[model samples]
Target chain A: MWRGVTGTARMCCLESLTYSACTRTIWSWRSTIREFVTLNVGRFKMPAKEVSS
Target chain B: MNRKQTSISTCFSYERSLEDLFPLISSAGFTHVSLGAKEPHSSYLSVSRRGDLLQLLHDANLRMDSIHGIRLDLPGALSSLTATAEAAAFLDVPVIVVHASSFDFDPSEFDERLEVVLNTCEALAPVAEDTGVRFALENVLPGPATELVRSALERLPSEHFGFCYDSSHDQIGGPKPFTLLDVLGTRLLALHLSDRIRDHVDHVVPGEGFIDWEKLCEEIRHSAYAGPVSLEVLMNFSGFKDQVEFLRQACRQAERLYPLVFGENAAGL
Candidate 1:
């Protein structure tokens, strides 16, 4: 019974760590995507550069 | 052509696969041409940067009447104006026509937008002055009145900057063409001539439309305008034979009507 409790606790801890890492990775990816979209939006709104042919 | 011919500025509509429009104008007694290049489509072959247009004008014994209708909103807009002006200057066209603002904004917002446009024009004035090219600001439907046009004129008084009086825009605003002409007469440098039904935005050929052509000719003669009277026509009208013949007749009518309305000595007057 003690082994079962300890194993269950260990498994929960591993699952929590895995879930936390995934959340962190997802959060970073979301931020990175946000930054990219923001930069592009800013570029498009600004006046285009002059190109002389 | 028995009579001396005036220049016909081609609108972007002429590129409707009717490639012979220019040649038709040349054959139909036009002595000069003004080519319009809309923004975003400036690189489009019809209005592209190639000097082929200028070359065509040269070969046809026609002088250029400046590149007409370049908006100030596009990327490199000022530079495009500058480049077109440089080309026009080289070709000795002397004037470039552009709208003060495209699309109508609210009257409440006009003052703010006018300030922006005026300030920008102030900045561009030096470039135009330096380059020896006149920048003509035309009136739009919701555009400034003769008063605003004059105020802008007073603020930025450069020889290379002036007003282009477009009859249709003024008529669209419900002003009598003669009164509008009289109001803008002093500052007017170029004329965009077309007949339109008052309160209707259609470009009916001169004399066919309800425009008082008699009064228009009278005003031009009275003002002693030596500049070209550019016929503003819809580009993709059907019946080439009809369009060509109508334009030629309009030219004749304008010539005949000019002397009679303004007096025979008006040309020299």
Candidate 2:
């Protein structure tokens, strides 16, 4: 019973570490994509009203 | 180029006092004047006597369309600009034209220097707005300086900030005159129309130089700008009469070309 409890605790720790790392990688990619889109698309897309005004 | 829509800069007669220049412009058949804020005529600095100046202009039958801000002491640029704005407000002038940078500016420190200028303009933008005047930055040499001004305008993004298209400077500078007009578009608030020969800023008669006036008119017609096409020539061709005739003829040509460029009965005019 003691051995089983220790094994389960080690598995949970590994899973938690992998989950955190994957989340961070996904967020980093998301931010990069957001920046690229904003720079490329947003630059030419200044509101027409702004130009007229 | 209706005489009613035309203006002449007093910088052409910078040696004369405003008191003297007003009568000359009025006598020349020009109803509007672009007041110069330079020495001998640094009248814009006399903030307390603004009323007297206005009365003098009124007596001469000349209206102030704009104020040409002078560049003297580099450190005093902001103060001069603020005073000019005040003068513009008091006189009910709609625009104030300013030089892009000082004559003594170091090209090596262009960006850094431009940043400082931009900061000054940003600080003064609110004052301009409060006084119901627009600050139009005129293009000076090295060509790329205008791009710097455009960047500053973009960053500030105020209705009080715009571009003053100086034809002679644009011709001397790298960009084609019409291209600068196109780039400026609706941001164009004032004009310093003069002609140039090659790199020389001759400020000669309009059609007598390298600038293609027809193309300029076309570009202006396409743009939303509808303001005075003010002449800023420094030299009189022969005498004051000849110079006035030359400007009057140029205005006629511009008026004739307007319909050709923008089609008949364009509403914006």
Candidate 3:
């Protein structure tokens, strides 16, 4: 019974770790996209859109 | 061919400031631009003062070829065109391309809108004469709108009134009973050159659509228009994401079209 309990605790810890890793990945992706736009489009100070044209 | 024969519209860069747009146009090898798409140019209009826009164009080494005017059938069109003429005269731009208000092309409605169109021409005549900025009524739609435009141009005085052919707009409705170039050829002053992808999705780059540039050049050769091959393209259907790249491509395409437009005999406008 104690082994079963330990296993459940381990699973929960693994799931928490996965969730944290996903959050970090998402943040990294957001920053990468922001940087890309700044370096390319924003470099020329362009609109990057038709913007109702 | 003269480099002055090549011009691009400011409509492609409406999102950018007027100051930013001129340099981009210059960098793209265009010596002239059609003042189009109201925004950044309207900002210049709001100021009662003049010479600022002229100075901006001078700095960029560009000239204003034409300005697109508001729909003449709309309310306050006279004042709007007057303001445009005032601006054009101040900037030394010679032509203003005016649109017919309605897109509905049913022939039955021609009678109804006929008076409105003629009145617009009459109203604008004084402004054109005074400002010395010619008004070129552009063909919006084929059926009733074309009739109205034809009637106005026929009945009006040609000294200040003329025709601005928009190839994209004419490409719609398949073919009209009388060709625009056939009927309005003699009075052509300015041109808004672009290709149509579909019915209403227009202003794509030339040679990227179904328009036969070769045949068009033949027809335009007979017309009275002797100005630049001013393009009114937008990046909307061009599949170009970068403004500078789009401008360069447009300039290249316009150059390709120059031989087609000017022919082997005289060179470009």
Best by TM-score: 3
- Top DockQ prediction, candidate number: 3
- Residue B152 in candidate 2 has what lDDT? 69
Model 3 Cα lDDT, one tens digit per residue, B102-143: 655568777767788788778888888899999888877666
lDDT of 2 by residue, B133-172 (tens): 9888776663456666676667766587888877776766
> For model 3, which pairs clash?
none
* Candidate order by decreasing DockQ: 3, 1, 2
Could you tell me the C-alpha RMSD of candidate 1 in Å?
Answer: 11.9
TM-score of candidate 2 chain B vs. the reference: 0.84
Interface RMSD for all numbered candidates: 14.3, 15.8, 7.9
Q: Model 2 - which docking category? A: incorrect
TM-scores of the candidates in the order shown:
0.69, 0.71, 0.78
Q: What TM-scores does chain A show, candidate by candidate in order?
A: 0.75, 0.75, 0.61
For model 1, what is the error of residue B100's alpha carbon versus the real structure, in angstroms, after optimal superposition? 0.5
| Greater-DockQ candidate between 2 and 3 | 3
